[model samples]
Target: MGGTWMQVLGLNWLVLSVTGSAATMGVVVMLQSLPVLLLGSWGGALADRLPAKPMLIAFQVLRALLAVVLLAGDSTWLIYAVALLSGVVGSFEGPVLGRFGSALVPKESLGSALALGSVLSSAGRIGGMALGGILVGITGPSALFAINAVSYLAVIGALSLMRTAEMRYLPTAAPADRGVAAGLRYVRSQPVVLIVLALSFVLGSLGRNYQVSMAAMVSGPLPAAPRRTASSPRSSP
Candidate 1:
């Protein structure tokens, strides 16, 4: 999810740079999440019915294009629109990624494979966040968006190198007889799944929500600007 992290950092920074308001930043983040709230299970079902590799690649490319659109936009509204559109692509991609793990490895090896994926995701997030900060500091938010656009090529390269003939995927089934409402019913039937979803919502609201404040902090005069002993001109007073 390096691309996701970079996208988040770039969007927050771009919004803050345009509006200079934490409230606006928070609204942008909230709008980005609205699609997930609205389209959760259809996304999951779509993932289950599709070939994982192509879906994953297409979403990443779309995400990169959305980032490029944001980079080119001059208006905060366009940036927020791109954020929402990118989120729509990501909402579908997230479930496919989870399902793809099972297809990539045997049942016996699933735990280790998942652990490895989690570790790599964590590392990618760290790198993306750090790189986003450096690029935003050095060049600007638009450049960070452009860099994020380019980063998706790495995933495309990795996918191209994989031997898909050796991989395994379940046969695509017809759409579930149940509708989206049924999907919710199915989820509610599982207490653990419901609990996890609830916890995710809580964490997203409180913990992950700090991107708004981070946007506010980084958008204007750098936080360290006043303390730049090495670069400041002589005091006039």
Candidate 2:
């Protein structure tokens, strides 16, 4: 979670730095989410077929590698490419985490477990954002990327150390439930699930891009305040 937030902050800062155009930043942000729109259902189906532990580990490693790729160049195109790859990995990561998290506890404690997870996630995000801004200011955005790379190591270590024996694995989905179409069919059969999915899609796409919007605002109008602060000295003359 911390690493993901750092990547968010670093990626947005890098985009604005490279292009100096809010429009381009928006496009870059959209490109990062494009994979979720295109492959999220497929990814969820994959999580049902595969063991979540290994898949989650693999995706985290892939994400850390992608963070390393960011250090290879400063080109906007390179950033966009890495962003797209990160998004693809993220789509799979989400489902794996969700399925794995649910399996980690008893049915009676599931609600408490989920609530705790949300609290920790929110805390991680807040910490990562604050740390990211500080790191960027102190050592530039690359430092945040490097720190994010290291953060994944901690997650990988924790996951490796977890007791697999205690987990309550759901029975593997039947052959018919092993594809994107199967997931769609199941969702369609459950009206509540279908409605929740639709609402999430709508809200997620529209509301979750605050990093992009804020980045654009900061890069554009927000900096003007600092300039005005500087010009106050001139005005005093």
Per-residue alpha-carbon lDDT of model 2 for 1-237, expressed as tens digits? 887788788876766566556677777777778998898888888888888898888988998898888887667777778878878987888888889998999989999998999999999899989988778766767888888898889989999999888898677778887789988787789999988988998898788878667866786768821222231221110
lDDT of 1 by residue, 80-129 (tens): 67868866886898888777767778778889998998899899899988
Q: Please list the residue runs of candidate 1 whose C-alpha ends up more than 4 Å from where it truly belongs after superposition.
A: 171-179, 216-237
Candidate 2 Cα errors over 4 Å, as ranges: 224-237
TM-score of 1: 0.83
Q: Choose the strongest candidate by TM-score.
A: 2
In candidate 1, residue 93 scores what lDDT?
Answer: 83
Q: What overall lDDT goes with each candidate model?
A: 0.72, 0.79
TM-score of each: 0.83, 0.89
